[model samples]
Target: MAGVRVIVTLNFPSPEAAEQAVAGMAQAFKPVLQEPGALQYELFRSVDNPQRVILMEHWASRALYDQHWNKQMREQGAPDQEQARALSPTFEFYPQANYDLVDGIWQPLDPADRMTTIRWA
Candidate 1:
């Protein structure tokens, strides 16, 4: 994929922990806004389950996203992976896809037709 969208779902042990994790991630997001190739970053709280939190990020490329993740942000006052793990021990990272709106329609940016069909389970 030329660009990538990463979706991460974190399942906290409690609602309080999930809220705390969101606060920590809000702080962590500051540096990401300044980082190159960081297109968009958003955090969502699950209405059905208060203990669940989701993070969606759009990057110029997978390599750039990897580079950003590789950086140590603890010294910069951002919560590190260990701290996040402490808050939410179970997390799920969805497969990345490159997609965008073209003429107000959702379309794959890359040549591959990975999202050609919508499968409803």
Candidate 2:
């Protein structure tokens, strides 16, 4: 691994709420429009069970990623904001691991219910 990739697994109160919100996110449709420092960003919904959501974020650097995570927008405002209210997300960033990708690509998934998953390596 070379750079930093933050893998955040948000545990919602229920699988249904998680599924509903994941389906409801029109704002999340575009990853490129997200924060500029994000080298890559992705979303996932558990296949066996829909409640668990995964977010993978690749940053220009670990420090940059840390900065982005600590910023008020992500820590405090992400929940209050309109695009994030439906999503009761819990986040975590790495203390170590320079997330260099061997293949440079992540898998993709499309669903009929309420989930969109994108991958980045």
TM-score of each: 0.63, 0.52
Candidate 1 lDDT over 4-51, as tens digits, reads 778877788889988887998899788787889888889999999998
lDDT of candidate 2 over 1-121, digit per residue (tens): 2345677676666888887767765356464336556776777989876777887877766666757657736555655555454555556664333223335643222122113333433
Index of the highest-lDDT prediction: 1
RMSD of each: 5.9, 12.6
Q: What is the lDDT of residue 11 in candidate 2?
A: 61
lDDT measured at residue 88 in model 1 versus the true structure, 0 to 100: 58
TM-score of decoy 1 = 0.63
Please estimate how well model 1 matches the true structure, expressed as its whole-model Cα lDDT. Answer: 0.74
Query: Which stretches in model 1 have alpha-carbon errors above 4 Å?
Result: 73-121
Cα lDDT, model 1, residue 27: 91
